[model samples]
Target chain A: MAVLQAILDGLMIGGVYAVISIGLTLVFGVMGIVNFAQAEFLMLGMFVAYYAWAWLGLDPLLAAPLAFGVVFLLGAAIQRVLIRRVLKAPEVAQIFLTVGMLIVLENAALLMFGSGFKSVSTPYQTSSLQLGPLFISVPYLAAFAMSVASGLALFLFMRASWFGRAMRATAQDPMAAKLMGIDSDRMHMLAFALGVGLTAFGGAVILPYLTVSPTVGAQFVVLMFTVVVLGGLGSVAGAVVGGLAVGIIQSLSALAFPIQLQNLVLFLVFIAVLALRPKGLLGGAR
Target chain B: MNRSTLLRGLGLAVLLAVAVATPFLLDPRGYAIRVVCLALLFAAMAQCWNIVAGLANQVSLGHAAFFGIGAYTSTLLLIHFGLSPWLGMLVGAVLGGIAAFLISLPTMRLKGHYFALATLAFGEVMRVIANSWSGLTGGPVGISVPFAPPSFAMMQFKETRPYYWLMLAALVVVTLVFVAIRRSKLGYRLRAIKENADAAEVIGVDTTRTKITAAVISGMLTACLGTLYAQFQFFFDPDTVFGVASISVRMAMIAIVGGIGTAAGPILGAFFVIPLEEFANDLFSSRAAGLSQLVFGVLLIGVILIEPRGFMALGSRIRRLFGKGGRP
Candidate 1:
């Protein structure tokens, strides 16, 4: 019964993990560059939602779109000014550039927001629904629902939208996409923006349950990478599977170990996965 | 030796003289000397990183694991068994080497980003363990080197000058190792692996063995530096020693900013980056909390944008422009 309950809780949190990790996979898919600063955008989203809730008395769920919109522009501008230069540079340059961005964003937030943790008070913050032998926390359920909706929306956009098709084409082959009249550069920018925007959206939805701080991104850095690697880099659907798998792994590990060892288990799993299946469990997909 | 080689040797001798005489010009207890010590230590760490990352093209982001292992190994030995840090450093090197070998066995075949991701996770695992194993690591509050009468054997000193010299010696030794490796058969094998692993294998290069050897040496050297750091600062936590940004990223950054694959790169990078960072902290710490760090980040971004190959490359580019104009 306890194991089943843990799995249930894991799925709820895993849904949001999928949403957050999707952006990472998407950026890698389109640009073939892993944005190490991807989690910082998630931090940005949390801040945006926090401010909206604190100042306007809006719920984080209601402010999610605003968070996405704001980060989308920031992500696009960053891609143009910084990431574009490193597109053709060596991998070391690409890695450090994102690292520098990570440092800048985190410190900038520390300067602006101070080091204190921020949380929003929602009516459902302490509420839960009982399901026979299990209980679902309202905040987790709401965040999970928002993640599912956003994930579905993203699926539709990718499947039905012209821009999405163009982006996929660019990911497949830039020269071929150029010959097909698709603006590869524009696709790159769009993919980066949308990728980070989705991560920020996940951040906003989870704002009710998690505290926002400048260093919050550090906590998710390894976790996000595990999700992407497990699903395979650049595979969106793989992120969903990886995220749920990670979530279940985390919850189950929590059952067996002390709280501090939780991340240890995750890290071990991550290293094992990278060693055994570098292409990801599902194989990489554009 | 060839003319260019002799000239380089003469230039290095002059630099060494300057480095040796620098402490005499500065206050022994001053902050500037402390910064210099830190620069030298980090420069050594970056050089260790360069062996694998620059020559072998196997970029590691988890070097802090070995670093922390060195710190904890020596500090714990001194605390528990009253062992000298010099001997503890040897023990730490062996352990760090073993850890490197263990990690490389599984990850040696991985390339580029995959290798980096695995190593990054490994570092985080070390940090988590160090933080959680409070009985051993003293938890998040951190541990301090026990104070004893100032003596050479203990590796503890009251004045900063001895540490500066110690760090300089370490840097010189690591730099010599780097140069020696660069000139050896192992160096050529590493370079071949860097260019193309499959091709290197086809040509009879044992790619896995070569990579594993480089990683073990790099890890062992990094762990030795960790002991030096422990003795110098006298206090450290898992976060600072095993930290991603503080130890791992900073080591790689210094190497990159100076010039990867070159002996002088980390040296130049360390002298440029560490002091600038200290100056930023001094200037902006009072104004805002993270302002100094923000400046550090901005400067790093600026460096990458301006010249990803680092100051060494930038210097040559300038010299070439002038040389061409003068000749014409």
Candidate 2:
């Protein structure tokens, strides 16, 4: 029963992880550059949602789209101004440029919002649903629902929309997509915007449960990377699978180990996966 | 030797003379000398990073794992068994080397971002362990080097002058080692691997073995510096020592800013970055906490955008613009 309950809790949190990590993988898929600062966008989203709730009396779940929209614009600008410059640069430049952005974003937040941890008081914050032998927390359930909705929306966008097809075409072959009269640069900007926007959306949904801080990204940096890498970098479906797996792993590890060892468990699993399946469990070149 | 080489050699000798004479020029217990000592210590750390990232072309982002290992190993030994830090440093080096070897076994084939992430995970693992095992590490409150009389054996001193000299000697030793490695057959193998791993393998270069050797050496040297840092700071925590941004990125960033794969690059970079950081902290720390870090971030981004090849390339670019005696 405990195992089953852990799995249920893991599934809920893992859905949010998938939503957050999808942006990372999507950007990598399209641009072939890993955005080390991707989680900072999540931080920004949480702030957006927190402010929306604090000032507007709007529920965080309702503020999710606002969070996504704001981050989408910021991400577009970042992709154009910063990432565009590094498309042709070396790997070190790409890595450090994002790292630099990460430091700047985190510190800028510290300067602006101060270094205090912020959390939202939702009506559903303490509510829970009993599912026979297992229990599901309301905040977790709401976040999971939002994640699923967003994931489905993204799936539809990729499958049925022109912009989504163009993005995918660019990811598959940039040169060929260019030949097809698609603006590869614009596609890159769109992909980056969508990716980070989705992560921001996830951030807003989970804001009710997790405390928001300038340094919150430190907690997710390895977690998100593990999700993407476990499924496969640049693979959207892989991120989803990886996210759920990581969430399950974390929850299961929690049952056995103390809270501090949670990251240790993730690290060990990450190393083992890298050793056994260098590509990922899904096993794709991307 | 070529004219440029001779000129460079003379320039280095003069620089060394100046560095040796720096403590005398500054106050014995002044903050400036302490900063210089830190600069020297960081320069050594950066050079160790350069051996792997610059020459071996394996850009590790978790070197702080070894650094923290060295720091804690020696600090713990001193606290518990009354062991000299010198012996603890040796033990730390072995532990660090073994840790490096273990990590490299899994990460040897991973390159670029994959390698970075894996090593980063390794570092976070060490940090988590240190924080959780409060019985040994004292947890997040941090640990302090026990105060004792000025003694060489304990690696603790009351004045900053002796520490400055010690750090300078460490930097000199590490820099010499870097130069020796670069001139060795192993260095050539590393360079070849960096250029084309598959091609190197076809040529029977044993790419994995060469990379592991460089990583172990780098890890051991970084650990040794960790001991030096523990003694110098008189206190540290998992976050400061095993920190991804603090130790790992700073080392890699310093190496990049100076000149990747060049012996003088880390030395030049350390001098530039460390002093600038101190200046920023001194100026803005009271008014704004993260302002200095923000400035540091901006500088990194600017450096990347302007010239990813770093100061060495920028210096030559300036010379080229003047139509002066440069590479051309």
Candidate 3:
């Protein structure tokens, strides 16, 4: 019964993890460049929602779209200015450029927002729903619902939209996509903007439960990588599967280990998964 | 010797003389001497990182694991048993080598980004352990080296001058090791593997073994430098020693900005980055908290965009642009 309950709780948290991590995998899928700073966007999103709630008296759930919109524009600018320059550079340049961006964003946030951890007070902040032997926190459930809704919207966009198809075509082959009259560069920009925007939305939704700090990305860095790697890098479907698995694993591990060791468990699992299957469970590319 | 070789040898002799005399020129108890010492120590650390990352093209982002291992091992030994840090350094090197070997076994086959991510996880694992296993690591409050009577055995010194000489010696030793490795038969194997792993394998380069060997050496030397750092600072914690940003990235960045695969590159890089960092901290710490790191990131991005091969390549680029015989 305890195990089942843990899994239920894990599912809720895992949904949010999937939404945030999909952006990372999507960027890799489209451009073949891993943005090490992807989590910083999530950090930005949390700050956006925090401010919205504080200033406008809007719920974080309501402010999620505002977070998405703001980050989408920022992401597009970043893509145009920084990431686009590294499309043809070596893997080292790509890795460090994002790393540089990570350092810059974290510090920039520190300078702007200071180091205080900010949290929102929602009506459901302490509420929980009981399902027989299982208990679900309201914040987790709300975030999960938001994640699912946004994920579905993304699914529809990818399936039914011309831009999505064109982006997929570009990912499949830039040269061929170009031949078909699609601007590959434009597709990359769109993919990057959408990718980080989705992560920001996830950040906004989870703000009721999680605190916002410039360094908060440190907590999710390995966790997000673990999820994406488990699903397979560049595989959106894989990120979802990996997310639920990580969420459950984290939830179950909490029962046995102290909170301090939580990230240790994730790190070990990350290393093991990478060692065993570099391509990930759902396997993105060769 | 050929004229170029003769000139290079003369240049090295002059550089060594200047290095030996630098401490005398600077105020013995002053801040500038300490900065110089730090630059030398960091240069040695970067040279060690260059062994694997530059030569083998492995580009590890987790070297802090070995560095912190060395630091904690020696410090613990000294605190508990009054053991000499020299002996502790040796022990730390052996342990660090073992750690490198252990991590390499599982990750040797992985390439590029995957390799980096795996190693990064390993470094964080050490940090988590250090922070949680407080009984051993003193937790987040950090550990202090017990003050011993000023002595050579404990590797503690009262003046910045002796430490500068010590750091200079360390830099010279590590640089020699780098040069020797680059000229050895193993160096050829590493270079071949770096260029084309599959092709090198077909030619019997033993790519896995070669990479593991480089990692072990790199890890061991890095551990030695960790001991040097622990003694120099007189105190440290898991975050500073095992830090991804402070130790690992800085080491890799120094090597890259100076010259990734070249002997003089890390030396050049350390001198530039450490002082620039100090300058940034001095100028911006009060008004803006993250400006130092912000400056660091901007410099890194600028370097990569301007010259991915770093300043070594940049020099050649400049020379070629000026219509010299240097290759672009």
Candidate number with greatest lDDT = 1
Alpha-carbon runs more than 4 Å astray in model 1: A284-286, B324-328
Interface RMSD measured for model 1: 0.9
What would the per-residue lDDT of candidate 2 be over residues B197-274, giving only the tens digit for each residue? 999999999999999999999999999999999999999999999998899989988988888888888988999999
Candidate 2: true interface contacts recovered: 0.80
Compared with the true structure, all predictions reach lDDT values of 0.94, 0.93, 0.92
Clashing pairs in 1: none
Worst 10 residues of 1 chain B by lDDT: B319-328
| Tens-digit lDDT track of model 2 for A28-130 | 9999998999999999999999999999988999999999999999999999999999988878889989999999999999999999999999888999999
Off by over 4 Å in 2: A284-286, B1-6, B325-328
As for model 2, its CA RMSD to the true structure in angstroms is 1.3
**Shift in Å, residue B283, candidate 2:** 1.1
Q: Could you give the CAPRI-style class of model 1?
A: high
After superposition, candidate 3 runs with Cα above 4 Å error? A284-286, B326-328
CA lDDT for candidate 1? 0.94
RMSD, every candidate, angstroms: 1.5, 1.3, 1.3
